[model samples]
Target: MKYPIIIVTTILLLSSAVNAQKRSAPDWVLETKEAAWQSRDSQGEANEGNFGDVWYSKDGLDWTELKSDVIWSKRHEQSAFVFKDKIWIAGGAAEPDYKLDSEVWSLKIPKRWFRDN
Candidate 1:
């Protein structure tokens, strides 16, 4: 099956009510190795310092975690794009050492999963 090319964009405008407070982007990674680093510190291992949680938002205002601990290694600064009915993540720095990642990961998204707006 074929799917249309979908482009996602987000824009945030601050209003007076939110101007006094600090807010992170809605798509920010909520989980990472650092969240558990303190307890695992004594294990004699450096924090992998990446995130494996997958998330999706239809409206971009509300996001839900789609999966936790995906097949790909935890990474940041990865490039994410939709190609051939699949979402692909490629080439990000894996944490702890901040070394470059060469692996590519992708997940197929069914057309039925999307609704016409």
Candidate 2:
């Protein structure tokens, strides 16, 4: 009886010490959430004429979407990047006559629009 009690107590103490050590250490595992985006290719099938919208996330969890507004003119294979406090979406393909096109576009985000941050 006493022996069993001692063994259980020892096991519990060991587990508690291990848990404490883990809590003190930095957490290495990442927690990710499922976020939905208004992917233009929302599916991989490509049919023209602006079929989607803008969506974004912070934690990659909760999402906010921009309604159907022409964020850009018709495009495909567009490469989007942020530079000079502006987003540049350039070099894409266009339909109604699939042709390779190069374009430089800038967004009008207020304050220091031309400065690179």
Candidate 3:
């Protein structure tokens, strides 16, 4: 009697809390693909070229393109990480050559990227 009532109340409270904690999905989706590229040594084609664009989110719901002028080239399978308050991207392959790049590029976060377009 009393035990059943307490159990029902606890279940209702837990369900309400779960419903309130639901989160909305991000605004932008990165659609990247490994494009086909001709190999240099005639070992067949290598699917290493990256075909996609970069996007940025201002509020997790509103997104915008990062602009093509800023990016050096389109690449995939690159290593990107944050260090010393900057975002670093390095060592990615592009089309035509598909050669592994040895260059490092960095963008200072917030200060460099948060400006109005």
Candidate 4:
């Protein structure tokens, strides 16, 4: 009984320590949010344009921007999901015209995205 209690206590301590090491959000995220909110408040409209920049975060707070040579057209309202160890993005409206897109794109883990042609 005592050995089991010690093992459980050790596991809990290690879990807490690991979780505490998580990185917090980068400054750019807060700045971007504040700027967008201010713009919407002043202009009475929110811009829905897409910039085609991709960012990924291991933790929900901290983000890292990814640069790739492959070009994807600017889009919004996209549906993304992970399936079979690949991230798939599909069914979004293109920017500037808001035309509906039926195409799909997939990115293998730690790899650049490729259009599903």
Instruction: Point out the higher-scoring one by lDDT: 2 or 3.
Output: 3
Clash count per candidate: 0, 1, 0, 0
RMSD list, candidates in order? 12.3, 18.6, 16.5, 13.4
Estimate, for each residue in 1-117, the C-alpha lDDT of model 3 and write its tens digit: 122323332332343444223312211122212111110111223453344344443322233445544554655555665556655666666556867877676656432432112
- Tens-digit per-residue lDDT, 17-64, candidate 2: 543232221111111122212224212345524332344333332334
- Pairs clashing within candidate 3: none
Q: After best superposition, candidate 3 residue 46: deviation in angstroms?
A: 7.0
The TM-score obtained by model 1 is: 0.49
**Mind giving the per-residue lDDT tens digits that candidate 4 earns over 1-117?**
122323332332243444324322111121121111000011112273454555553323333456678846766566666677666767666666768889897766555889996
Given candidate 4, what's the lDDT at residue 31?
A: 19
Candidate 4: how many backbone clashes?
A: 0
In TM-score terms, which candidate is top? 4
Query: lDDT score of model 1?
Result: 0.40
User: For candidate 2, what is the TM-score?
Assistant: 0.46
Model 2, which residues run further than 4 Å from truth?
1-42, 46-52, 68-70, 108-117
